[model samples]
Target: MPSPNYFKPSHPPTIANVPELTPYYYDNSIRMSPMERAFFTKIAKKDKSGMVGGSDEAQFFRLLMHATGAKKALEVGVFRGSTTAYLAQGVGDGGKVIGLDITKDYLDEVDAEEFWAEMGVADRIEIRVGNAVDGMRKIYEDENGSGTFDFIFIDANKDDYDAYYEWALKLVKPGTGLIAVDNTLFHGAVLDKNHEEGRAIDTLNKKIHADERVESSMLCISDGVSILRKK
Candidate 1:
């Protein structure tokens, strides 16, 4: 079910320049009670920043998983497993997610078993270390792999998004597959011609929008996200 406070598409909430509002957004979207919010607030206030999985981007992934009944998922950047656990639980124990990260610094901050125990769906999660491309390749070449995924979240290095998208394209089947790219808006920098990040994301957006291989929607939510459903 959609959270009661889900900021509508027409009236999207603006993210601040810092991670100050991120904790609030994360707890808010989880639909927690006041006490629960306080608990998360404590953890969030101690957060100095650069925590990847707790961003609003994670909310988008969770909704996508539920909306499309996505049982198989791939997260290119798994920082602290915040989004990984969220995605894994949303689809339940029957689903699986390949959590790929270049390093485990953020993931090691919290105990995986403890986190998964709370989620009640930890068995479905798989953690992999390496670059996104290598991790993706390993999954595809697995002997018992289906070579098919219901959803793929590209939140890795900005420079490698294009490569990730291209690689993911070959592994999906039409109609039931969803590919979502995060940080495409680059915190509204994409609108400024002076920002290099803007130019890079702008280029990716146009390319995917024009591609006939998939049907797409560009959502301005949380740093700008582009969602493509394989045609």
Candidate 2:
């Protein structure tokens, strides 16, 4: 059985129930530049996977970056570069966002480099194509065996969540850096007995909860997001 608190909502989802409030709420709270707006629209029209992070979730990421004063970030998944663009924007001038993906096909399809240039964040974003684990390990070694990132976002294959978290600890600054994992609730599938991805996510969720090296909170923002701050 799944943990009782696993699927609980962090807050009421009135807007979720009422779809009309989506645009209204986003217009009022989330600010997107013209380039960002164009990029989202382009992705929606072209990409059919629907894997892009939602507006509220993107806003939460931006807020987290601002709150932590994060200048360096690492993103484990770079799906179509939507969230990567948001990460770049969040880090601001002279900041850097390292994005890792299993393939370069999606990044090419989205013309990510050109888009980043238009957004004036080309220098701040670097796309590393290959296995995420290997890329993360290289980053750790390159940092001279010390934590170098202020923030890390993991949203890759669910089965590899634990591995990503383990590496994230080595890459993040203790007591200050934040590690945010997406889709922890897995669309409430964590309650299903036979769902492989859900089971993997649930395992990581429990592990994070009991981890003495970090302070954690699980919020049901979009599918579910778990934030961990290492001590």
Candidate 3:
């Protein structure tokens, strides 16, 4: 009863075809737009670290922008500008995303400028290459030391997360701005208390939990994203 094509070497089945990868997730997941898929594919091929956020996570960022009506956003880490692109889309026309990365090597490798141009959001993105803290500080100072950002995302080095949070608190709008910290779970290492990176995140988590200036939630999305809304 086998068909002639039964043993044929066809293209690999993805979530669109094989819903069995994670039945519940695949069944209910929101599908990526064509542009999003292309960007994701490009990053998957170029990024050796495999650290890019998943489509779901990227969608969450976009949703956050839409929900908050955020026009000005900042991303502390700009690895290949994958999430940066989503953030740019979330901000919409006339909005801006300030991306800070330690190096432009990854961005250059991925032809980020060309891709962003192709997506029609190149003008909305501003890339600053330098030490994260220094870059953030410069942004903070350039704006005359006031909280001006509607949203700020932190995904840089774990050791500097606390410092990044400190600056984020200073840069985001008061009483309404949102701050998102990625990798808060540190791959469940925070639970085991065995990893140095995990310990650092745990420390920051406790600090954020205790801080009264923001209402926070630890969303169990990709790698655990902790979102804080300034009060």
Sort the candidates on TM-score, descending order. Answer: 2, 3, 1
Taking the tens digit of each residue's C-alpha lDDT, what string does model 3 give over 88-195? 988999999999999999988888888888888999999988999998898888766468898899998999999999999999998878999999877788877778
Worst 10 residues of 1 by lDDT: 33-42
Q: Positional deviation of 206 in candidate 1, in angstroms? A: 1.2
Which scores greater on TM-score, model 2 or model 3? 2
Score residue 27 of candidate 1 by CA lDDT.
Answer: 64
TM-score of 1: 0.77
Residues 3-92 of candidate 2 have per-residue lDDT tens digits of 566465554457656779867877788788799888888888775556777767877898889888999999999888888887888899
Could you give candidate 1's per-residue lDDT for residues 105-168 as a string of tens digits? 6655555546665657678888888888877777777633344888887888777777888877
Model 2 misplacement above 4 A: 1-24
**Pairwise lDDT winner, candidates 1 and 3:** 3
RMSD for all candidates, in order, please.
6.6, 3.0, 10.1
lDDT of 1: 0.71
Error of 1 at 31 (Å): 1.1
Q: Which candidate has the highest TM-score of all?
A: 2
What TM-score should be assigned to candidate 2? 0.88
Global lDDT of each model?
0.71, 0.86, 0.85
Model 1: residues with Cα > 4 Å off, grouped in runs: 1-30, 33-57, 142-147
